[model samples]
Target: MHLAHYLGLLHRSQANLASAFREVAAAHADEPDIEHLCLRQAAICDTHAERLHPFAERYAEEAPREPDRLHSTLFSGTRTGGIALLRDLQDLYLMASECDICWTVIGQAAYGARDRDLLATVRDGEGETAAQLTWLRSRMKQAAPQALVVAD
Candidate 1:
């Protein structure tokens, strides 16, 4: 079943978001609130990843066990926040976007195949990532002004 492909994507998002969350937390350490939030989101991603692991095996399809190649999230900030923090935040937003897309893909596949279990799992994971993305976007809006204002 193509469920393997979907599961692979879910795992990839887990890995990327987990990495992004930790690194973004450290990269934007000046913002203690964001740092704490990323750390918390990372924990949630990890938990969901673990829960989805068993399903991957159950729906094994001999496909490659990786999807980061399809959608890379390995972001080493390009716009170094002051500027650095802003860039990292943008990357986190991108990752969150990817997470949303991945969840949507997984949901469509599972539901189309009438796999209720997979659909439910993906839905729950989607909610967690959505919360993280919503928070990140709100924080980004708050920080953009300070980041753009260059002082003499």
Candidate 2:
């Protein structure tokens, strides 16, 4: 597929992932730590979505939306049965993984593009997401094991 197509896909995926985090945060808002991290993740996803908007428009592609319950059901059902801290940790890790995928795709696009501005933007975004993922992973490690939520 073309670079624009790939970018569109990335944008949609990030949006859905962000939506999931928002849900998790809302579901466990009683916990400050979970709420804070989920809010941060939602903000990042919003930024990423905005960045991808122009590309989607330029390519005449529809951006991806948050999946409905049917889509989420394929994964683990709503993350419950865990301490608030662990639930947030799990959500963040999932978000990190989604961000990593976006980074990889954007990095590939940067390599293929001749446009310096586009390349630079994609590369920078990729780097930012990678750094965020690293930070989240580190925090996950430091948190209590029981706080880490995992989905099959």
Global fold similarity of model 1 (TM-score): 0.85
Q: Per-residue alpha-carbon lDDT of model 2 for 4-118, expressed as tens digits?
A: 6566667776777677667767877876576687778778878877877776676565444433332364336455565554545556566556657766776676666655665
Position 151, candidate 1: lDDT = 47
Local accuracy of candidate 1 as per-residue lDDT tens digits, 35-143: 7888988898898888788777888733454445523434744334276776777777777777688788888988888988888888898898888888888888887
The global C-alpha lDDT for each of the candidates, from Candidate 1 onward, is 0.75, 0.65
User: lDDT, candidate 2, residue 61?
Assistant: 59
TM-score of 2: 0.72
RMSD over all Cα atoms, model 1: 2.6
> Which pairs of residues collide in model 2?
86-147
C-alpha RMSD (angstroms) for model 2: 4.4
The segments of candidate 1 whose C-alpha lies over 4 angstroms from its true place after superposition are 61-74, 77-80
Question: Lowest summed lDDT over 10 consecutive residues: which window, candidate 2?
Answer: 62-71
After superposing candidate 2 on the true structure, give the runs of residues whose Cα lies further than 4 Å from its correct spot.
Answer: 62-77, 83-88, 147-152
